[model samples]
Target: MEESKPVSYYIPNPDDDPTNERITRITNKIKIEDLIERSKRIKGCKVFQLEGRFVNLFNEAYQAYILGMDYTTVSLCALASERLCYDLIESSKITFDGRIISNIEKESFYRIPFSELVFFSKSIGLLPDKVAGKMMKLNNMRNVYIHPSFKRDRSDPEKLQIKPESDSVTALNNLIDIISGFGK
Candidate 1:
């Protein structure tokens, strides 16, 4: 028989009270408005980066089409990565192999595996088959961006033609709403 894994738990530290000086030192000293602004700024940056990648994919596909090259794979993958990143940020967790993960390594947040993400998304009611169709389109684009072969041809003058026509941005906005719910 296989050994069962122990359940993990997060307990608050008795010695680490909010009034502690050490805790205060590490915590934000800024106003609430400043924190909100910062959060918005970070979110905006992520969205901007995603858009830039999408643009690159579209441009690459266009160029490839013009040159009669098969660039669909690369272009599609880039768009997928962008969408995956957006989903990851919205969910605040990474999924893999049917497992919903919340405590991934700090550095690997952006490199979450798609299979896991898809599984978790389905499990959490955050992504259903109908919505997943839209997500799949984005995920396909991400695969192309991460693959090395596609990266090499990014600088080529050939352009890919992809347009943003979905409600992904609105969907992502809902994440902010979900996160805000935690404070209630």
Candidate 2:
């Protein structure tokens, strides 16, 4: 006669099966430790302007970095950079002689591209020059990471477009600098 297998082998039932319950408990404990480590690694990071979306993205980006998800860290940093630029632009205004310049409508906000947002933020003194420049570079890196056309054009076509780990660290540092400069 065949021995009976735990239900968790086929269909996990953590609530009923002792094996699944143990697994759930172990995974939860591991997650707690991981979260503590990740939090320590990102202790220097703070919410950007107290915006919930920006805060979430920044935390996720740092978590990716801590987890060794290099590419994801870079991509998330780029996304967070874009969000900060957009927020700055949305809240800022240029007034000349009592005229409200740089009127940006909420509905038409997404129409503005990432590059333009970065430029506008820097041009209007809403974003620091260093932050803008780094953000642009990070954005470019993220794009290259996304579409590796250079590899296709290469004679050997074997080398990757970017050095994943090093580039990710650079991207994260650039993003951290930007946040440190602008974040609350």
Candidate 3:
């Protein structure tokens, strides 16, 4: 009978292992710094993206104004206005829930009103009544947008000659100024 050879199994040593404590410590140190730097870069990118998005929204609102599309113009203006309000609240370190000013926390003092977000801005001393009035007009335009029947004549595709009121540009520009002030 032939003698059978015994197989030897390889066992890794924990202490002298290449992937052991020493390497782990070095890797962890590098990972920590790398994670922090990555976080900072991400934050910077987020700020840039947010600014770009805000600018684009503003530009679209302006273009809608030029095109005399009242509903579209006001809709874009309201969205950009709301974004500006939220950004202001965030930068001010004010704690509130909701992604939009219209949906802010119900229990907080900073709670925004569904119909009078401009009042919240006034309460915060960020805007005067004159400025708030512009927002109110935009709010009215928002209502007009939501309730299409209120201005059905303008909505008719065949009524292409129907033009939005001249005041639309003024209202949008006022909103832009109000929001831009917050960034400064």
Q: Highest lDDT: give the candidate number.
A: 2
Q: Which candidate, 1 or 2, would have the higher lDDT against the true structure?
A: 2
User: What tens-digit string does per-residue lDDT give for candidate 1 at 75-140?
Assistant: 443354445445445546555678765554523545657656655555766555544544554455
For candidate 2, lDDT tens digit of each residue in 1-184? 1133676444456566666666676556445565565545443655434653777887788878777678898899999888877666566665657875555544355687888877876887888788889899888888877874634235556544567677767878887888787643
> Best candidate per TM-score, number?
2
TM-score of 1: 0.29
lDDT string for model 3 (12-117, tens) is 4675777776566655654445445433321111123344355677668766665455557767887777665555555454434634433244235335563455
Error of 1 at 129 (Å): 2.6
Residue 139, model 3: Cα distance from true site in angstroms: 0.8
Stronger candidate by TM-score (1 vs 2): 2
List of clashing residue pairs for candidate 2: none
lDDT of residue 143 for candidate 2? 85
Candidate 2, 59: how far from true, in Å? 0.3
What C-alpha root-mean-square deviation, in Å, does candidate 2 show against the real structure? 8.3
RMSD of each: 19.5, 8.3, 21.6
Off by over 4 Å in 2: 1-49, 94-109, 150-157
**What clash count goes with each model?**
29, 0, 0
